[model samples]
Target chain A: MTVATFEASAPFHIPRWLAPFVVLSFAYIAVPFIGTNYLFEAILLPFLALSLAGVGLNILTGYAGQVSLGSAAFLAVGAFAAYNFNLRIEGLPLIGSIILSGFVAAAIGIVFGLPSLRLKGFYLAVSTLAAQFFVQWALTKFSWFSNDSASGVIDAPSLSIAGIAFNGAVGRYIFSLTIVSLLTFFAYRLVSSQTGRNFIAVRDNETAARIIGVPVLKTKLIAFAISSFIIGVAGVLWAFTYLRTVEPAGFNLDRSFQILFIIILGGLASIRGAFFGAALLVVSPLILSRLGSFLFGDLFNSGVLDMSQRIVLGALIILFLILEPDGLVSLWDRIRKRSVARLNKRKHVGRAAQPTQ
Target chain B: MSGFDWQFFVEVLIGGLLSGVMYSLVAIGFVLIYKTSGVLNFAQGAMLLFAALTFVSLVERGVPFALALIITFAVMVVIGIAIERVVLRPLTNRSPMTLFMATLGLSYILEGAAQLIWGTQVHGLDLGIDDVPFEVGGVLISQFDLFAAAIAAALVLFLSVFFRYTRVGLAFRAVADDQFAALAVGLRLPRIWATVWAVAGLVALVAGLLWGARLGVQFSLSLVVLKALPVLVLGGFDSIPGAIVGGLLIGATEKLAEVYIGEYFGGGTESWFAYVVALAFLLIRPSGIFGQKLVERV
Candidate 1:
């Protein structure tokens, strides 16, 4: 949809309204025209889904100030819930199953979030782990969740909203994009609303928030519920849109850590940070491995190279935490402010002094 | 399965306590750092793996066992001090969660470096202790488990004495009791932290050696950290004896549950059983059975 209308006064030049149009066209039209299916399948799709998960996590850990290490469990619950909904109920639309799956995940999240009332910080963190372990155990142990498959992996049905089939890579990418944008919009609205302020209040200090009449318990539960709902939707995207086959094993402790790292490295308490973090989390390893092979191509085999890549990844996480605790988004903000300030100063001087790089 | 078996129950209880000792060993590493500093050191598992791998690799390269032990200990001291200097010192005044995440990051670095230095093949660490079971009152116990429990007891005794008698130990207790007060009294916080981490590193070495022999020095060695977390939750994060008792309770309950009712849950309940136990315990006592009660203020 168009966000702004073009002005006739700027007809000869590109109007402000046309800027978003140009970007939208580039994203939807120019990308697929120039890029291959490999790019869509390998990179774009996963990036959107993971960023959505990061947003989901940022709601709880960043905004609510509750540290959780069991996000992957909720993701798995959503995927499996969607899978079951699609299977059990006949004639259900693709969107129907996805939304229902989110509710299911939210319910599980609330159950896990129950402990937050009694526990705080590291104690609560460990309890969330119980949710992680138990959910994975149930998913893998009960073959019924997998539709009686011994392998415990499910083949997600093909996606068709209304009459359009999103069976191809571009189709899936667009579907994921639409869903992510819609959910992210709601998340932005949610965080800015009174509910969002309560989240911040509780995060800052539960006792203070209570003194101010914010229902501490309710806010935490709502944070968990909303966070899980979004994460669950991301799970559906991860399973149905990105991966060919969905399995419980796909969402592990490592995946939880990845989402946590995304928020940590993206800067906590920011919406756009999730995107920056997701992009880096998804792309950095590929860059690291490629650079490793390029530099030490003949010296080490794949095993040694893989190990080195991990070392670099680990080192990078620490370096980023120490150097940029606010995340890459903060770094971006600094550069943007500096450049904009320089531009304004030059305009006042009436001389186009070359901006410092 | 039909009748209540008293003999089997005792045997399982004994075995669980012994395994609990192993867990307490790892938890001790966490407690050492946490007692002196509020940071929940998640890298304890990785340190265990690194120390074990270093020792086993040295021995593999024809170094004598005693020499390999000394070399591994020295390496652990250097790594501990380096971590304190680089990671812990800069991150000193951060919140517990931030420090927790940093240590989580540290785990990655340590795990990666350990595997990168020592090739990824699994190595069997032979501590030369026989695993044969000896029957006492018609209950069988593994000799190796008994040996590990004894070592854990001795280590606890030594630590208790050190904390009781030494000047540095008194400094550690003072810092643990109240960091700001200790600082006001002119205690050297960094040196004390370094010493604490070095001691933790040594604890990791001892844990590494024993666990390496039991589980084989492999990538999964780091997973022992998971076992220690529940132990920490049960025992309280900052208490040494809390760790020991917590480990025993968690170990015994999980084992009993696994044997008695595991089939109902389709078996393999051990993975999450300790966590479930910890969660249940948390509902009753958030700080743990013996952990210092946390007080919050505006």
Candidate 2:
């Protein structure tokens, strides 16, 4: 290979310029704790919960190459299961019940995942759609799933760990942050292990992976099991820490598509991309609605805003897919690389100008 | 002890079948697009809503009903051509997954655009067709139902003939089978795509007009149009006959479940019963009733 080829393939290194910005980001996240109740509860907590879900989905569709459209169904299952467990199993700790619900979700996820062995792509997608319909049906049919609540909604009691009650916004934010950080760390480690490599292999080519003794079916089932467990935990957190009272209608097909959009716009197959994608999905709508109201005032009410939002969102997705299929993460990477190259060029010019020095 | 009326059952059955025919009309739009483009137009249902809304709004403005319909149909056809030229052709080399996502986005875009242009409020649409119920042997059927069924059948027959014997139809089939081969033989792919989308638009117009007459023209039209999805799933994406058969089966079963088994679960099974049927079908016959058996090299 030529010298240029070797240089091009070299491992990407972060530039010094971005280091301070990365440090400041952590500081910004910490600022929320010092903020008032409204900001913490209404915004940051829910946003974090959504970010966790996005990351959970990133594990399945992004890393394992499974295109699931029934993610919201699993989220619903987790929420309801946790609610039931918390109510029925007397004196059970909240964390324990939530963890137990994850197992239930993983089991259901694996059963639904069995179809993946015989089908894939669009076929698999439709199969998952079945899961969405079935779960919603079961929820509506079996009133016990919603605890026979009059409105088909479930309310979870405040979570307490060893008598440290997380009852409000501040308690909830810390709880969410702690859980998200732990899960993210585990996800990072999981993605770096042998199991992760197998997942990538199976995703890249299942049949080839099978031929090469990668245990394709088992690896895929494992991916589904693990991914569902994470998603289930995220769901439990969402219902308990965020919404507080959950219903079947709240976790509908639109929610599923919204998650799918997050992953695609975040950058498929990248962990950090989930966070970025979630932030965009959450933030852009807020910004757009504000702008819409400012421009049109009362003329563009919620109904009109909703319609325009749908149109703009659709157009943006198509535009992004055509122009930047790799998504926002790749765009960030490209910008960073360009800046680094420019800096290097300046350094080289200065050295040449120094002559014998 | 038990006094069950057989005539009521017959009435519901006939009503269900007529609705099935209407669903088949919507499914046909999907079939034509899928067959020609190999992309499941998730927005097919939205197109129906848009066309019906446009037709109703035009007529409500004092335009002649017939003139409004023709004009609305032409507008839908133009939208079809625009979709092919602007959105689809650029996505030629992308994966089917990408195409699916694109169509989902397109569906959202169309629904939003429909709401924007036509307003979200519901509108009454009178098609100048018969609305009285027909009675025979103690059973009753709506005259509008018969009209819808007859119109759907006529449209399907016309489409079959168009695809089978026409020059453009031949070009469509040729392009569907292999794009590269069609190009080698000197077929203008863009032109073919445009024509196929236009035909799909016409099919959408017929379905929208009938369905809107039944349910009234409104934003909720998109929700009802989603029934086409389960139909497409069970019929196979690219199979026209499959769509007809699938739509009929879903219609019959969903109605039967709602009438008979709905009480067992406190009712409302009608909302998702067809999806359950399709899901079971997917488990049994994943390729669907008439879908081409997929051959994977790997």
Candidate 3:
């Protein structure tokens, strides 16, 4: 594929990438207006929330070269913290509660990230499992997190901002879309910035990064902070917008693996890849179940269907690792490159004919 | 609070030590695969579940206990070889992260396959050991615990001797020490890997039987491996003895904490206390006790 270089003197010209993204953004905004309620609630809201979590994980694991298996812990922390902040503090707006929850999750993330300074590879990953189990335990053990609910489940308070209630599926979808878009925009800028370069350097080689004047420890911690902040917000969206009722059990080890799979399947370290991974994770099982029922009628029981889903998911992960480790984004890139090559060949032929004339 | 009951403490310690041997059994499987192939085999838990489920299901169908055990062992050996051929072989020379993820994928496949083959209902696995507690020196101990410990000891002894005396054992050690050197010496990497996986699978079966006897063969039987993570971290991932000693320590500490410290946190701290202990230990000694010092060259 050829790199598109913009002239330094060019003023106020949008990049070619922005054209497709702009159209996509408009369609995203129009979804609530044009699409069915089931499409908005059953599909898009959860996808957006999980996509944001995938983006957060991609920053730390993909860009910074850290493998964490405790992302669900941060999600749980974010959700519970937001719930507590909203419940205890009177008259505090939902936005403040959400941002506060993000900060809280970031702080905890930095604390857990400290072990990364000494541990590397699978060792660090195992240590992160401590956070996963510990967070889950804490949330369940203490009734304070769940507001002392008998069932240990907490309901999200109605979301409203500046006298406008974002309560229904449409409102929640728009709210989640706005939050995801803004966070994704920030993530794009962060990945391209000097700090982001430091993250890449640290991930590629910590010793080399340090020798070349990159602050390795700080870079790692910052990656954790930013990633957790985004993930925490995703957690808030997961609780308040998508599920609407939160339980600690919902954010289990499996959930963490699911998010990790999203980044892996979507294309690690790419912002667009997070969304792709989330969409696939959310939509594929539904499609697979539908196809399974249609194909086999009553022969395919739910238990068998569930088992098949897991087998398919596992096979897909292995296949992606073997065939395209860079994931679907790389596949898309290859296709685009081939088409671009063909277009350039046609253009060159046309120029040759014109010169002959 | 009634001045610490010494007898109760001793009882808890003894019970914890016995169960720790069970954890060690699972941890040994991890060490074997990791030592040979450098893969952290997260599927060890799933293997344990599959082994136990198969054995129990066979026994349920009126297969004698001994026959069921033999058949399960054969099935596990086939699985070990199949996994090595299909998954590990293709993904050789990848980063540890990639290998780790493959094991994670392997785990999902194993879990799903286990449930699909043997329905998800919980099953009772009786190894014929009586569960009645016997008193010795004012501390009560379960007869089953003693049996489990004996089995664990025998397994460890057999493994140590096997690794020390046999020709294949020498090849295994050589491969574990340096894969490239082993390859230069014409040792077939695939054969060694298949052997190590088979050994690990055998270890998982023993662990599964013991744990299944204690807790019943259920979906949660697989989750016992989570408790073994602390044992691996504390003992050092690559050391066999480390797994044993680490397992004992985690088991004792977990019981003691659950009995004493759990009250402050409203009980049930055993679920995560081991992980916290392991995390703290990692902060102090990143390589873990008895683990070879990792020397990184830039």
What TM-score is obtained for chain B in each of the predicted models? 0.98, 0.95, 0.97
lDDT of 3 by residue, B144-246 (tens): 9899889999999999899999999999999999999999999999999999999999999999999999899988888887988889988888999999999
Point out the worst 10-residue segment of candidate 2 chain A by lDDT.
Answer: A1-10
Model 3: residue A6 alpha-carbon error in angstroms: 10
Cand. 2 Cα-lDDT: 0.81
Give residue B207's lDDT in candidate 2 (0 to 100): 88
Per-residue lDDT tens digits for candidate 1, residues A230-336, read: 99999999999999698898998889988999998898998778988999988887777778778878676777777776676667677887889899888986776
Of the pair 2 and 3, which is ahead by DockQ? Answer: 3
Model 1 ranges with Cα > 4 A deviation: A1-25, A350-357, B295-298
The residue-level lDDT of candidate 2 at B39 comes to 77
* lDDT score at residue A271, model 3, on the 0-100 scale: 85
- Candidate 2 vs candidate 3: the lDDT winner is 3
Q: A1-357 in candidate 3: lDDT tens per residue?
A: 113342222222236677557856775666667889888778988999999999999999999988999999999989999999999999999899999999999999999999888888877888889889889988888887898996579998999999999999988988888898889989988999999999999988888899999999999999999999999999999999999988999999999999999999999889888988999999998898899999998977899888887878887888888888988888887776556555555666654422110
Report, for every candidate in turn, its global Cα lDDT versus the true structure: 0.89, 0.81, 0.88
Chain A alone, TM-score for each of the models? Answer: 0.91, 0.89, 0.93
Chain B TM-score (model 3 vs. true structure): 0.97
